[model samples]
Target: MSEIKHEVTKDPITGVETTGHVWDDTLQEFNNPLPAWWLWAFYGTIIFSIIYWIIYPSWPTGLAERGFLTGLSTIEFTSDKGEKVTTHWNTRALLAQEMQNDENELKRQKMVKEVAATPLADVVKDPTKSAFVLAYGKGIFGDYCAACHQSGGQGVIGNFPNLVDDSWLWGGDPADIETTIRKGRKGHMPAHKGTLSDEQITAAANYVLSLSGEKVDPELAAKGKEIFNTKGCSGCHTPAATGMKALGSANLTDKIWTQANVPGADSPEAKIEAVKKIIAGGIDREMPAWESRLSNDEIKVLVAYLKLLSQ
Candidate 1:
């Protein structure tokens, strides 16, 4: 192997020195020392960081008794808002104490008591109270409902109900919303595979689609309509197929076919299959109860927000 030779060069324009390193037979790395100010600044940061580590909560010693140093003590100071604040050496302890501040705690308790005492309907009717209810309810919804109904309350098709829409399986009353949030709801559609014929189930699916104003074979729909009336579909759906809110049956008149459509653009074949599958296998939608999870005041606030959605 031949030894590499150093070919140090200088630029003619600025007379800058090169580090004898070449790239693509053209560019060369400049051999320049960093500026004095930059060097000093870098060294300053190292010194400052060292001092800071000694003065603040930096080390994590395994020993529990003498693990950390308390560099700062509890000191009373005025805030930017002209309020006096007593800060503790430990951040977590300071935060815990802040949460129990006497004046703030009293105000929070008073607000909660007022909201609990007020009726849900009366709170919704009042603009001032409704504003508070909506703000508070939004946080509660984020904690509980957002997982299923989503943060915007626009639920996924076939899985959860879109709270923003006027369509509701159960009644859209404030009391109804409260009851639903507290006790939860379960909707079951019995499978027809064990009872009805395959052909009758297919016809029923097409007939159900036709009720939502979708185009279907008139002959199949006619025969399905007869079957629908006699085969117990009308028991929960009612004679007109308008759906019974008391039974939490879905309305077939509206074009809101939850299972038929999806979140994004989909093919017509997919919609048909979804409807047919529901007719054959049926579905059971259950909304878990929140009575034990949330307080009565929280439920009332959620009811107010949900009622406002349909309106």
Candidate 2:
């Protein structure tokens, strides 16, 4: 064990003594003088603070210092008959009013009508107009459809269809597109977890490919056909089990698929996976309503664009 010792060292400038104890083996420190530059810097800061307090806002009073600007310019109100001067209104409020007044001067109702009235063909064909509209539409797409549909409008397939492609699950009419955009879309495929066995789910998926000119696995098709009719697919899918437009149940017989459309996916083996998920989990796609987020004009433009896409 090291023996303890105590000593006191006075500060060189202030003359205050250290507390009669040392902390470590080699290092020895004591209350000491502040550097001349530091002491001068401290005094300079104090002087600067006093000057700032006199010339600018500070504690001890609510009044603004003489040099501080409160943004309330002295407003002169001219008399109607040149008699009395009115009170000074705040400059900020006046600036705000002026800004609002000037803003309307640029694009008032007249300008919007003038812009919208231009024939859509003229707008679409013109690069300037098309660029402006596309730029505008990109922002709208991000806010409304980007949640379920991706930022690029490439939908999360097996649930939603790709808008870039030709296949449309529902009618691709402009009016239909508009209705779908405004209202939203929901596809109903009845759940068959307990209604059909794992074997049946596998078979139904295989049977789905036969409609698309894909060869069927004989063993799977035999089992799938029995499950399809017994499970009442024909109710919504019609007698041929092709499709029923009323319920929007897809025509399993068509080559155009609204769901997954990978290359060689029409094959029974490939389709079986898709069908199994649909039968076991059931597919549900909900496209949110855009009535609240977008203006009627914006919706109209979108409707026209979607219509043009299908063609």
Candidate 3:
């Protein structure tokens, strides 16, 4: 029987070589050594992983009482002081205590007084003080007023007066505004939509515009004037179509719009919107009760801002 012998060759560095075998008539696989950089990187990773495992809470420890000893036994981490450090997190409680603490009482009271005494314009004029007041106001406003007043203090007209307007349905006194804000306010005006037709509404709207002293389209206002009396809108709006605060009926005669007034529609448009809102929603404006929601000091800040609006 004929014998076939295997061939071998020594590698240059590792001194290792593959069994003598060739494919595709010439191709051969070689045994090679890994580069120093690659070898070192691999070792480094292993060492880092070991260190990380030791320092951090990994395996469970039986000595749970001693921070480090318990942690080490349980494979948990402990501070240098040999105690387990725990995080402390709480909110509302801290705020409540901070707000009422004897020391805090004076600070909180002072903050409220400052807010009440300071006009909004003046408060805003200062970068530092205004920023604090604004942030403080925003939280209070959102927490208490956002439900009815909306995020931007924009209220539903006829239901809630928009705080943005120059013509305030109620007197725009700061203290008064604060009182109205803190305590819920309800305004009632007889809905005129039922009695007034589209035509009379149009006419009365025009006349109401004239009350604002702004020039109205003579033709429309003339029509509006007739409807104003015909619809008996004067019963509550008065002969002048001016508001009767007693009934919380807004004075239609003023130029300052209580709600969003469609520009060109003037009196007619404003009346249409007001009438529609009045009929659909009924006259109910509520400034939320802050007694439960806001601290006494927070309400004072609100009063301050409101006073600034009028001043």
Between which residue pairs do clashes occur in model 1? none
Residue-wise lDDT of candidate 2 within 229-277, one digit each (tens)? 7788767777686686556678777676666453436554666676676
Tens-place lDDT per residue, model 1, 208-255, is: 878877777788888888889999999989988988877788887787
Q: Write the per-residue lDDT of candidate 3 for residues 1-311, one digit (tens) a residue.
A: 33433456655566679556555544456756699999999999999877766654444456544333212222222343557534222244335444555686656567666765676667668666665666667777677666766767766643456665545665666656666657756665555566766666555555665777655578977887777676666777688777665555677756655543434355654545554454333465445566667656677776654443334
What lDDT score belongs to each candidate, Candidate 1 first?
0.77, 0.63, 0.59
Q: Which regions of candidate 3 are displaced past 4 Å?
A: 1-109, 113-132, 154-160, 212-220, 226-232, 259-261, 264-282, 309-311
**TM-score of every model?**
0.64, 0.56, 0.52
Deviation (Å) of 194 in candidate 1:
2.5
Among all windows of ten consecutive residues in candidate 2, which has the lowest summed lDDT?
A: 106-115
Ranking by TM-score: 1, 2, 3
Model 2, runs deviating above 4 Å? 1-133, 240-245, 256-270
User: Best candidate per TM-score, number?
Assistant: 1
